[model samples]
Target chain A: MTSPTPAILPERGLADRLTALFWRHPRLLLAVLLTPPLLWLGVVYLGSLFALLLQSFYSIDEFSGVVKEEFTLKTYAELFRAQNLDIIIRTLVMSAAVTIGCALIAFPIAYYAARFARGKWKAVFYLGVMLPLWSSYLVKVYAWKLILAKEGIITWAAEGVGLSMILNAILAIPGIGGNSLSTSPLGTFIVFVYVWLPYMILPMQAALERVPTSMLEASADLGASRAQTFRTVILPLAMPGVIAGSIFTFSLTMGDYIIPQIVGTSARFIGLAVYQLQGTAGNIPLAAAFAVVPIVIMLIYLTIAKRKGAFDAL
Target chain B: MTAAVEFLRVSRHFGPASAPVKAVDGVDLTIAEGSFFAMLGPSGSGKTTCLRLISGFEKPTSGTIRIFGQDVGDIPPNRRNVNTVFQDYALFPHMNVRDNVGYGLMVKGVDRRTRDARAEEMLALVKLEGYGDRKPAQLSGGQRQRVALARALVNEPKVLLLDEPLGALDLKLREAMQDELKALQSRLGITFVFVTHDQGEALSMADSLAVFNEGRIAQIGTPAEVYARPRTRFVADFVGSSNVLPPEVTRAFGGPMKWASLRPEMLRVTAADGVALAGTVTGIRYLGAGSRLSVALNGTEVAALLPAGQPVPEPGATVGLAFDPAALHVMEGEG
Candidate 1:
């Protein structure tokens, strides 16, 4: 059989010609494919980050309340002042608490979903984790606010169950407590944990899924009892996912102004401080400096986590 | 003396109760102390499941499992005193080779120094003395396999279970590891229960082996005995290439009217004259060491293994096959 020559071959369509051209110059096709997302990342995301960083370097004039465009460490030095330092510390503590809380609560749920949930149960688990996320964030926060209020179902239930004294005792604690549950740091914390839990659960579930059943079997077969196997094998293997989940919870809690503003004490968080300073107070440099705190904290956190081999599993 | 491991009519089922998959069914087995025992079968033949039952990973539905004469009912895998070298060599990827090897000791609350020393010693035993610092991911497949072995052995369990430990290796590496494994088992004097699908691996490494079919043990005996005289068609067909003859063929060869097994190597193909059985040569396959000649006889096909340097017969030619009368093994039941 004689093969058809190019002269007698059918003409190629535009799509075919483009495919042939792409097949010959693969790098050109890659560049074409990557251009849109690369531009979005480089210009919009990183460009804004660089602008914020540059803004943080400039200082606000004390008397004129005007931002000086020149680079100076004066605005950064202002961050060391007692009142501003209080907001930073408070935000840091809350972020850590929320992250730890999310982790503790998410682990068992994620473990159950990863190791046991199958077919219909798996779908139900995913729905349970993601159901709250489908609601608007502000709506969820406000709903939590109502749930934690003085006349809310929790307080009523506690009273009905003869546990109101315990509830009152918890609310009577100094810095976290307020006149009502809606006006307490604990309420803010509860809302924050509730908001960020799904983020924690999904990553943790994915990490736990990657842990082979054979690994657990091997560990048990080696004479490591259930608790020992959990400590040495399961926990260490799940650390990366925990760390990944913590990144979301920690950073989100740090930057959230709305939750604290609506629920907590009159004292402010870093996000609220940044909001007030940049808007009403017109201290853009200080606001930018406040925003940089979570970034710097996360950098240190990631470094420590990496050293502990958290990303190794990831 | 009590067997190292014993199963009394164990059965394990999976999925729904209405029509469950019987992974293992009514299996009774015993492994002698300090013996290298292999469970030989194809995939899903229940050999691996039986190994898991011994290791306490899977519980038997209807029977007791005794390890070292102790009924291990409801005892978890960790307390069973048997360790498994998983098929995929499930060495902890997060830990270094030393830590992985010493995990059992560490979990037992042995001090760091003792764990380190014992781990290093086990690594040396596996001929991987200097590779302790590397992660499992850092090592080659065979190295990881050795680490898994060291990890399991460091526990010093009464019985060691290997689930196709050499299945992942290449032919050369697998053969070398098989010899090393046999040597190690004898030297340690620990009971070794190995599982494999490869008949050659089972025949070579095991002191005694069981042939599993479906979910039951078809036969169990020493390599030589099983190879020379398989009691069933499945054993003869699976263990090695054998010419299974029907009852009519057995009768034609002046044997009792029963199913029979004839080893391929026992038959000699010649010109179709004055022979016990005559057939047309259907196929000739070169096997480097010898040739396999398939002959159609008595309404069924039989193969003859021709040694190297023999004159090969062409297909479509009628050939006579000769074998000693005693070589035809009469099986008890129909396949």
Candidate 2:
């Protein structure tokens, strides 16, 4: 028996035509999909960073003190001046201190939440960590300023508890201590740690959660002490999370000028100096050069962290 | 010798008091020293949970557990003289295999030289001599299993616990591992307590096996003994393939109780020999080694394993099946 030939439809739907084109050229389709976001990130965000870096290389005019369009290392050379170097060091030290403090405090909290804490308690802990973040950052910084004031609740409580002497003793230290914690480098460090702590805790909790209960049991079964198991099994495994959290603490502390402005005494941090240079002094090249310090430091830090396998956990 | 591990009415309950999930309920077991013991069950039968209890990972809701006559009820898992090979291997992903294997030694403050030597020795023992420098992610699934075994065995604990260590491997690789584990256990002269849902693995590898059924041990005996005689209905069905005769079928020939079980291999079939129980072959399955004939007998069906090269009968052909009196395993009690 002869079968009748069927006629093919000539007109193609838009979706069908696009699908056919995509099917025929998958890589082109992928490029089409990814182009917009990649274009946005590459041009808008990274383009400014690249431009800022280029601006750092321009020379500062000797007489006019204005940024010269000519490229030179004069501004970069000024970065090594003693006072500028001192501010860089101060910022570095503070960033390290805040990162360490955040890690120390965040780890125990994350450990408890991930391994042992139950339903309602886990939610409570999560809310406690996250709830503070919903408030304005400036508000929290100001609150810390009030809390650390000479006539603040902390000093009053310290005095009431006969701990004022201890507080004064702590305030007498050379670099970190000052008249009052509100007017101290120590207070800035504390505020930085407080602000970035949630960033530390969440990553730590996630990393700890990925650690199988079986491995912990395995460690125990192998005749290791509780401390030994934690040292050998838990801590080494949690390093990635610590490194990830350090990224937050370190970068946040390094870049923030606001906390130092409200809470610090006489010390100038990298961010504050950079702000003064760019805004008040109109030394864009020098400010950009100073800004390159944190960027360079973070690049080095991320490299070291990557070597230590931090991104693997992420 | 005294048992290496003992569970005295152990039970672990989770969730609210009103309706707790009984992961392990009043389990009393004695594991012999230097023997390969298996806790066999289907998923959620509490075998792994029982292993956890023995390893001190979980506290029993009631009862007590002892290791080498010492009560370990209050001991944390790290203090226990037992090592576990986790199902997922649980090798430290951050550490090289040498470090992973030697972790317990390092924890004990063993010097680096001694730890390295022992880890090296363990690597060689698992046939992964050069794999010591590699990471867990760098190794294949089977190689990772070996690394886990080496890690647990390196500690030389009183007993080693393996939680479905072979569950992740392919069938061919799993078979090879089962033999390796048996050999390793015997050579090391260490008590091994492993859990698995695979009946064939349990039967082949266990010196003594316990069948777990819904948080309780259904039966415990040697592989041969359990297979020859399963004491409960659950065991008769779950331990291996068996034709569980219905009450009507048993009563048709006045054989036994409301529930009786017969191993498929134990039954013999004949086309026209006019055996006591007569039936028609409803279905025929041609397995490589032998064939399984599904017979429709008096309101019930039973399976009989026919040897290869037999004169096969077509479907719907009349047939007769017979078995020895001892083949009728009376499945009694609530399993």
Candidate 3:
């Protein structure tokens, strides 16, 4: 081709050359940009997870206090032992309770923020939801530990309100009670729900915000009362958000060790069991197996949510 | 018979109490039973607000609203015997078509079998007989509109409110739905309050219509009366493309020195042969059926519609405009 009068082009520095290269082969540019994060996720995250899974398939030598390099179901069989099984069931029950509690507490706050609060009030809502997350998680757990103590403000307030008898009656209940609120399963549950509430509220608020105002009006126009409209329209439409929020609350509760260790009676949850088994007891295989339980439970939960059409809204 | 819905000087206001935005102001209207009534106006002109007031979605800031002779100002939408087909056709995404249509019945504690049968019947009425298994997401825009109609009609409400139900459809589908809706309204013999900004749809479908402007009813009459003898400059300007002539221009055209409306279709163009209303042709737009000629007369522009194959004047040519005296309808009162 014959050249025309030459037009001046910008000096092809590294940035200019890179831009030209990117324009020529977009896939190559994408690969170059994605390499760092992809390597981090693949090598660091999944690599450690693969190691854990491999360890769960191995057994520890009983007499030598050493991990055997042979793959066997002996470690898996240890999960069915009476003490380990008890810990699993207790943790499952606590996780389910905490998830349900978080959902109930988060829904009204989320709904108010989504549908009613505007401008400054919406800013306040977001600040209130996110403020706790910015504070130290251990600090909040410890604060709860104090508030729920035997001689804390709650007990003093109960006494001031002449409700000590009622409080005593509640503390007399079996299985959930200990010497006081701070050492009870109920206390642990309260802390779990409080800690995870922001997770549930944000996703639920996002879901609720997506629901059109016209839909509610249409339901009411069709002769459905407020309650009916809420049940038939609002709840169903917000299910995907609920499921999304529940994934966080449920999994977080299932794997939390701090709250149970610090607040509740010495009843070992799955997380505490995993912690103690790996560290104090040096039973790494059983700890790995215990860690796998929450992952398996989450997979089952997600599958059920998918089959129920929860993610369709998302 | 009592009016199906009556508004006694109703007004709805929003925003600050110090200086509120009057969405609907001092409006008195009556929708007759068994009539297809249209509320016609541009957006934010209070037509949709009026529909909401009747459906109890919005309460009047002042004045009384009556349904079938009873004052229903305090009543909620669920207690009112009316249903709305939303502009977006807000069908429930999770439910199948049958369940969505049957939701009202289900809320009323009707058995599944009977509500299902009624829903199916309603679906068939809207010509959607066997599409009950699909979710709303699976349906096209037109199909979703049909489902919304069926869902509202399944309740057999005394009053049916449609808020720009056909606004989202294509031209052909909108025309077909217009005919179908008109047929359904007459066959059912129930009051239907439809809201739209489209003048052609209002003229073709409504038994009677109220023309709204600036949060007030400019005029309310049969479609022909509203289209032909509009009571104000606003109505004449909004309802159809009419040349709104000022008092001086009206007098120049031999009118009684009053504000008047001259429809383009009523004006004729001819050579400037010593005609009184002579003007220079500024532009000619070729419409499919006819051509529109814009003529500048005494520095004011007036439009004339000439039928196809009629001789068209070139731009900048002087042309005479002629129209019958009766065609210049005099409007009453300020807009």
1 or 3: which has the higher TM-score?
A: 1
List where candidate 2 sits over 4 angstroms from the true fold: A1-13, A16-20, A117-125, A159-162, A306-314, B272-275, B280-282, B311-317
Which consecutive 10 residues in model 2 chain B have the weakest lDDT in total? B249-258
Count of residue pairs whose backbone atoms collide, per candidate: 0, 2, 0
**How does each model score on lDDT?**
0.92, 0.88, 0.92
Local accuracy of candidate 1 as per-residue lDDT tens digits, B147-213:
9999999989899999999999999999999999999999999999999999999999999999998
The 10 consecutive residues of candidate 1 chain B with the worst lDDT sum are: B326-335
- List model 3 lDDT by residue over B1-335, tens digit each: 76999999999999998999999999999999999999999999999999999999898999999999999988999889899899999998889999999988998899999999999999999999999999999999999999999999988999999999999999999999999999999999989999999989999999999998878999999999999998999988898878999999999999888999999999988779978899988999999899999999988899999999888778999999888998999888688
Interface RMSD of 1: 1.0
Every prediction: chain A TM-score = 0.95, 0.89, 0.92
In model 3, the clashing pairs are: none
lDDT of 2 by residue, B1-335 (tens): 88999999999999998999998999999999999999999999999989988887788999989999999989888778788999888888878899889988988889999999999999999999988888889899999999998998887889999999999999999999999999998899999998999999999999999999889999999999898888877888888888877667766655764778889898888755657788999999999899999998876888999999888889999998878877787766554
Q: Write the per-residue lDDT of candidate 3 for residues A41-137, one digit (tens) a residue.
A: 9999999999999999999999999999899999999999998899999999999999899999999999999999999999999999999999999
User: lDDT tens string, model 2, A148-198?
Assistant: 999999999999999999999999998889999999988888888899999
The best candidate by DockQ is: 1
